[model samples]
Target: MSVRLRLAALGVAAATAAAGLALVTAPAAVALDNGLARTPQMGFNNWNATHCSGDFNETMVKGIADLFVSSGLKAAGYQYVNLDDCWALPARDAGGNLVPDPVRFPDGIKAVADYVHAKGLKFGLYSSAGTKTCNTAGFPGGLGHEKQDAALWASWGVDYLKYDNCNNQGVDAVQRYTAMRDALAATGRPILYSLCEWGQNQPWNWATSVGNSWRTTGDINDTYAKMLSIFKANIKLGQYAGPGHWNDPDMLEVGNGGMTDTEYRSHFSLWSIMASPLLIGSDIRKATPATMAILTNKDVIAVDQDPLGVQGTELSNANGLHVISKPLAGGDRAVALFNENGTPATISTTAAAVGLPKALGYQLNDLWSHKTTETAGKISATVPAHGTAMFRVHAGGAWWSNPPAVHTSADLPLPYPGAPALVQPGTTTTLTTTTTNDGVLPGLLGEVKLTGPAGWTVKATSPTFHPVLPAGRDVSTKWSVSTPADTPPGSYPLHVSTTYYPGKSTSDYDLTVSVAAPLTAGTTGLGDDPWLSADNGYGPVERNTSNGESKAGDGHPITLGGVTYAKGLGVNAPSTITYYPAGHCSAVTATVGLDDEKTGAGSVTFEIWADGNKVADTGLIKRGDPAQSLHADVTGAGLLRLIVTDGGDGNTNDHADWANAQITC
Candidate 1:
């Protein structure tokens, strides 16, 4: 929940208190009390994944609704099944009324809406408040036909309306949108109104009473960078969103292919904590299990739907690390430990940093991992690159300061990059988990179990059953864990849980088990799709292209010093990427320079690190400078790190490229 300020468009009229142009200064801002959107709206929107494509049709809309119930989205509290642009025909009928696309909705719009209503779901559609819809195809808009279009939509049982900002014809944004808002209200039917002004006029400053939710930023694509950018802009606008009115930061892009699974989880976690609208932009009918898992996580979704209607805030965002805190009902706090770096990091913060009251013991419920553990006061996690560690923290009321101490830990020799075999695949390790009754009251211990993935054998080597653990006492259990012979060599996560008496109070622990595998050896190797970790200054790090713009897949070919390289990383300054050479690589080399796209306005320094040691440096490489050759000796190094630092000045136009990066193995 890092706060960010965005660029502005022209024709924006500055607001002043003397001009009577009201601005939101506090949570006292009032919303249209239509008794709708008591929480941020949730459901599906066919925009990001489908866009203005031909595949968007009545069958697709119906299929989404059918999948909502069958796929558990409905049971997960998704109420609206909405459709975005391209749903209307190019022209209206003879009655001067908007027309549903005849080919797409052959059965008519009402029939499709009626079908959705019949399935116990609400319906929504899209249009614009201007002369034409956003589609360049020139579909009719609701500019001069507000009342007529609103009446038509109410007749079709449309439950929501997303009024966009295109073709406004130089009209004042407030005037134009307010016209549609009044038109929809006068229709005598309740329709949740969403203002999609793209924050051009600073909608959050004045749109509370205008609609149920107002788009506070531009459209969102499915990329880690884009999602992160939107969260930055919206998280600070929490004072503007409430029960009846919300600030829309576009829609969800969970299942889209642009980002990794870990990034998608962070995206979902941020949106849920921010209380943003959860409009799934992916095609649910074709969603993968990983995608479905992210969209249907009820524990996280509960934070978004928490009746408190309080949006989360950014407690801190420093040096690519971020912490977000959302207050939930019943004195619970939803905390997010987000790592924006391209390297794995242990983000640590005290409970007080997250606005939690002092307590003897606190329960940290891992929303993503679904593990509950007790903590004395600290909240920390070793988060992966572009990953988030989310927890629901609650103060333990009756538990003593020390609480019931349950520690599930295992120790094995750490593996070296190329040292003799250590903890190789198909090996057995001993796991020792201990539990102690440090609480004031005596407690009876329940079953203590250690669980791993399929094909992994786990046997209790020591006694696990402890009927009663009196005060100031402890018990220990050891389990023999073996990896499957066919198991692929990589890091694996294992879980163990132990419960105690009285309320069946539970404590769960997570541990990582690494199995050493041979490293892949190569020359002229590059960091591409399968990056171990990454963090950038502006947008995503592109492959084989200059860091061109703020969107993924929007980069030019890798050009530097008037020469082009086929393999390298295109990144902005203030970036870091970690690669696992696993001691197979002896040297790391690259041709580095500022991308030609910057002309002569950017400056940066590129450096290479081996196992936490700086090995190569390109100091103050500016635009139009000759490409510099960087070679780092990474002998016996487990990790090779590439870094791009802004040259003293801020990171403006600082797009640097590593051309023809290679590893000598």
Candidate 2:
């Protein structure tokens, strides 16, 4: 049996977690009282930014401590200032004690600890449970010298120990980590014990009393893919995180410059809701406004540090969209609407959907936007690709989980079929939005306004306000929206704002301002003015390129069977794209294969459906082989679907490509 399943045999709670794994908890008699990291330790680690670089010296460490206070990070609960690997020399001293690198820390480890302590910040050091550390420098680890190393760290006033797993020489992971845990306990010091075991041995199943926080995934890089992967790995283990012992999904990559601000905000939101340790991994000294704003989002941080010790659980994960709910201390719910898709889409969940009790009106606080709005009951947002919309939802209050946000959708009976109705330049269309009062109480609906690009005319045709909106009802507000005469032929952003309580509460929705295609029908298939009704995947699918690692990054050319194509769609595995054909097309053709990128490490299957009927399929294509050609008949099909699956294996590098995809009438 897997280690996760074995938790029941180890006197752990037999109840299962949302991930369907056995929820493990240590016996009350054995709960470790390290008196540290009661609510997922918040701090900074130098590994992500410095990584043993020349600049990661005493001066840098001191600068971080100084900035921590001046930058208001300490006030926001970022206390510990920790150092990662490579602080020590490759060899120990004559007495077999680990020696600080003279060039890096001239005054020894204690001096740096003292300096940090002077600033009212705790200090941490890094080591491994094996003979050698993980880095190539091969610094000596504390494998056989657990007690001795623990004493030395305690003597230096080290407040935390991030003990990694490397070069274990085949020792059982539990035994190896437990040895260091006992040693730290023996020191009679209150230093926090962190297990950087990388979840290889299912630390969540057994590390409750062993370490304060254990790494549940591999190292995190400054990329959306890595962050999302780490989140997926750690989100399921929420049942294990509590006051003292928590799950560590590596460290934060906030100011690392690899991802967009939107993605960084999503990362921070996910980490916070999961109750993971909030360790700032970037160099705060060089942090920008965007990075700092994301790092110190106080409302979101409050959710992370909620004294209840309850981690967020996934309410729903469907079609690359996720809704997570974390129960706060005082009956508040921190709801996260996360979109893992490549395109912007609306993600939402009602208060009732998140298990909140019935209330008159729910006040919604947008944690990222920092806007206070009220929802009759619905909670949602137009979450961007790789973005998250966090809301502190409660009935109404000043405590941790208070408020509900609004949920808005386009009214049915659209003028044109399919999503994102195409409209001509300079033309006016009647737009109707459904203003919902899903709350249990009556609501006062005020001015409903629609704002769009400059020069676009958007005026409400119907009454802007319905003084009293009853519970579980919707008000359809119609607006005459007109585009500029010279409007561009691309998707635009339009926001529809509705005030429920005049100046006090409001709700908003981001509407996709779709316009006419620049070219109605090009030689390429998708250029034929076909509207995309649905597209969802693990990662965003790119146009005319192979799938990227994450986000809508510039992907590699569509190469299949060693041939590069100029026109096609690049998609990750488990992807589906439904195209609304503008006119009758006899058939669709394409060369399907795994993209040559990823160094030939992918397995995928491409399938096509016409009018809900499976028309063509390239079953099970692996890497390093020629492309498979596909031709699907769709004589009278109004919709065509392009799908990619992970070939019955987990989607690791499944970058599937549709090469030279075209349609023939």
State each model's C-alpha RMSD to the native. Answer: 7.9, 5.9
Off by over 4 Å in 1: 1-29, 70-72, 92-96, 129-148, 165-176, 198-201, 255-265, 287-296, 317-322, 337-565, 569-577, 581-638, 642-657, 662-665
Evaluate all candidate structures by whole-model CA lDDT and list the values in order: 0.77, 0.77
- The residue-level lDDT of candidate 2 at 583 comes to 51
Each candidate's TM vs. the true structure? Answer: 0.70, 0.76
What's the count of clashing pairs in each model shown? 1, 9
Number of the predicted model whose lDDT against the real structure is largest: 2
- Provide the global lDDT of candidate 1 against the true structure: 0.77
Worst ten in a row by lDDT for model 2 = 18-27
Worst 10 residues of 1 by lDDT: 1-10
